[model samples]
Target chain A: MIISVASGKGGTGKTTVATNLAFSIGADVRIMDCDVEEPNAHLFLKPEIEEKSIVFTPVPEIDEEKCTFCKKCAEICRFRAIAVMDQIVLTFPELCHSCGGCVAVCPEDAISEIGRELGIMEKGRVNGIDFAHGKLRIGEAMSPPLIRKVRSSVESDKGQLGEKNVGKINIIDAPPGTSCPVIAAMKGTDFVLMVTEPTPFGLHDLKLAVEAVKLLGIPAGLVINRADIGDDTVKEYARKEKLPVLMEIPFDRKIAEVYSKGELIVEKMPEWKDKFRDLYRQINEIGSVKSASHKEK
Target chain B: MKIAVTSKGPDLESQLDPRFGRAAYIIIVDPETLEFEAIDNSENVNAFKGAGIQAATAVSDKGASVLLTGFCGPNAFKVLDAGKIKVVNDAKGTIKDAVRSFNDGKLSFSDGANVEGHWT
Candidate 1:
């Protein structure tokens, strides 16, 4: 089963929950960080790098030689990446969606595609738990493409069996916000583990996230971090929304220190490993129950 | 040569719109005859992105040799530069007055975009 950890607000404990769960799940799981813009799961997991690859996205490039300055290319470009003046045709690669519409519409065949640097994706292992993440290039405007790339990489690697890959549980550490990148990470996952706090801001953003998950038709639960820091509004909300509150981690100084030192809670406390395991069991139980009801319907 | 002025309304006496990309109207005029046509820019004003580029396309398609507006963005400036359409930034007052300044040779073409792109 694929579980994606997400939060609408930034600086929530998505990385913390995802890393701990992967560490506790231990052998039969692979953690993929789909937050291409600022992937922090690797910081705590400290996975040893084994393989790396550079990722790229297609953007339009124009050839002036064989080109008639027909305005057709410009007319067909939805992004306005291609503009044709009387004498010259200009192409703004950054604005291009690489839809190839301009190339398809060009009567003179002047437009062609070239690869633009998206970023780099690295795969590694931490204590037998597989890890992978993508780092978007600085100033890259779009991240959904890279996030999707990371998702596909993990699923594709899972297809090539026989390398002691006895795992089917894929944990996705999604990016913050309900935008394209977050949706890209959460799409196609079996369950969504939403990490949040107990504050009003958390409740507001969690509502937004739950709305998004509802639209995606995915079953999601809550893991309340810093549980005692704020009010009971979040819990009240979870209860009212019929969303299960699976786990709660109190605001503890030692937990913060361990996180700051880039250490895992399952490794440091050792007892919390069992707690994370319990959390997974609860999720599994809820997932099965929900699916059974769907089968009945 | 024709000059295009960004305006808040569809007339020569209309207030000059500061932003070229999201201007309400684009008045294409001939300085000699003072004859003009107001092109409604609602499509660009409502654009989610690339408004400047779309505006530039409209201005160039109108065969305007110069554009008069208070602020122009980089993307529009790129298309205008490619079209060899001179952009005079910081244009203010009524549309007619800005065109008069151009006719009197008092207005100069801007070097580049004056403001960063305003993303919605």
Candidate 2:
């Protein structure tokens, strides 16, 4: 089963929950860090990357020779990446979405796509768990494409990894926010585990995230970190929404200290390992029920 | 020369909008005749990204040789520069006043972008 750990707000313990869950689940489990902009799972997992591949997105390159300054490319480009002013045609590679609409609309066929390096995808192993992540290049605004690339790479490698006779569980550590990148990371997962703090900001962002997952028609549960520090509003909201509170990691100085030192909570606490395993079991139960209902339909 | 003045309304009597990308309207005028056409920029005002570039394209498409606004960001500046559209920023008052300042050479042309991208 593919499960994604996500949160709407940054620093809400998505990486913490994801890495812990990966370690608890043991072999035949793969963890993918889809937070391309600032992937932090590696800091805790410390996977020895065995393979690396550069990720590229197609950006338009205009040919001045075959180009009639017809302005067709500019008119059709929703991104405004291409501008045609009289005799001059300029293309901003950074702004291009590489939708190929400009090339299709170009009467003179003046536009062609050139690969622009956006990021890198790395695959490795850590404590018997297959690890993969996408690291976006600094200043690159587009991350969904790279996130999709990392996800596809994981999916393609699943068969090879499955030959070990161990049950497969794909854990995705998604990026923050309810934006396109977050949605891209969470897409295609069987279950979504939303991590949040108990604070008001956390609850507010969690609502947004819940809405996002609901819109995607994905089953999601909540994991409230630092559950004792803030008010019970998050729990109240979850109750009202009929969403299950899978686990609550109370606000503890030791957990904070361990996390600050780049150490996994499961390692230092040891007891939390079973708790993460329980969290996985709850997700599996929910996944089975959802699939059963889906089959009924 | 054709000049584009970012404005809050469609007429010359309207206030000159401070924002270039999210300006409500862009009034393209022929300086000699003072005849102008106001193009709505509402579509670009709420754009999630690339608003400046979209606004620059709109102004360039309107055949404006100059842009008069309060500020121009890097992305818009690049597109404007590529289109050879002279940008005169920090212009205030109504659209008519901005046009008068341009005609009188009171508004200086900007050498580069005055504000960072996504100032709002």
Candidate 3:
């Protein structure tokens, strides 16, 4: 089963839940950190990266010598990356989505795609879990492409590592927000475990996330971190929404200190390992029921 | 010469809009005859990205030789420059007043983009 851990707001313990859950689940599990912009799972997991590869996105390059300034390429580009004026045709590589629409629309065959480095993807193993993540280059606005690249590594690994050994449980640590990057990471997952705090801001963003997952037709459950510090607004919202509260980690000073020091809570407190395992079990139960109903539909 | 003035309304009497990309309307006026046409700019205002570039294209396609607006960004400036459209920055008052200022040489043309992209 493929499960994704996500949060709508930042610093809501997504990395904490994802890493601990991977450690608890043990054998035949893969963890992919799809938060390309700020992948923090590596800080806690500390997987010794065995392989690294650069990621690239194709951006348009104009062939000025063979061009007619027909303005067709400019008119067809939705991103406005290309502009044609009289004798000049300018292409802004930064604004290009690499959709290749301009190239296809160009009557003179003047546009060609050149690869631009967007980020890097690294693969490693931590404990027994196979790990992979993408790190987007600074100032890069597009991250969905990098996130997709990281997720695709899971498929490639399944083929190389043998289907039986790799497909048991794949957990994706998704980025914050309900935007393109988050959706890209959440796609094709059996379940989404949304990590959230108990405050009003947490509850507000949680609603937005829940809506996003619901739109994608994925089964999701909530994990409320620092559950005791804030009001019960999150729990109330979850109750009204009929969403299950899978686990609640009360605000503990020791846990906070350990987390601040880049240590996994599950490793420090072995008893919490059982709690994470139970969280996985609850997720499995929910997944089975949701899939069964989906099959019926 | 055809001049495009960013305006808050569809008429020449409307106040000049400070924003180039997110302006409500583009009033194209023939300065010599005072004849004009107003084009809605609502499309660029709601655009998620590349609004300035798209708005520049719109103004260029209207066959306007000059653009009068409060501010212009780098991307928009590049397109407008390539289109050979002179941009008069920090343009205030109504479309008619802006046109008068342009004719009287009271307004100065921008050397380049006056603001960063997404300045609102």
Best by DockQ: 1
Expressed as tens digits, the lDDT of each residue in B44-68 for candidate 3 is 8887777788788788888999999
Candidate 1 residue lDDT tens string, A1-297 = 788999898888999999999999887789999888888999999999899998888877778898888789878777778777776778887777667788788888777788988899999998888899999998887788888888887674433544544446789999999987899899877789999999989888999999999999888999999999999999999999899999999999999999999999999999899999999998888877877887799
List the candidate 3 regions with Cα displacement exceeding 4 Å. Answer: A156-166
Range of the 10 consecutive residues with the lowest summed lDDT in candidate 2 chain A = A157-166
In candidate 3, what are the lDDT values of residues A256-287, reduced to their tens digit?
99899999999999989999999999999999
Task: Provide the lDDT at A115 for model 2.
Answer: 97
For A8-85, candidate 2 gives per-residue lDDT tens digits of 999999999999999998978989999999999999999999999999999889999999898888778877788777
Residue-level lDDT tens digits of model 1 in B9-116: 999999999989899999999999999999999988887778888888788989998999999989899999888899999888999899888888998889899888
lDDT of 3: 0.90
Candidate 1 chain B — worst ten consecutive residues by lDDT sum?
B111-120
Tell me the whole-model lDDT of each prediction, alpha carbons only: 0.88, 0.90, 0.90
Ranking by DockQ: 1, 2, 3
Q: Judge the docking of candidate 3 as incorrect, acceptable, medium or high.
A: acceptable
Question: How large a fraction of the reference contact set does each model reproduce?
Answer: 0.46, 0.46, 0.36
Interface RMSD over true interface Cα atoms for each candidate: 2.4, 3.3, 3.2
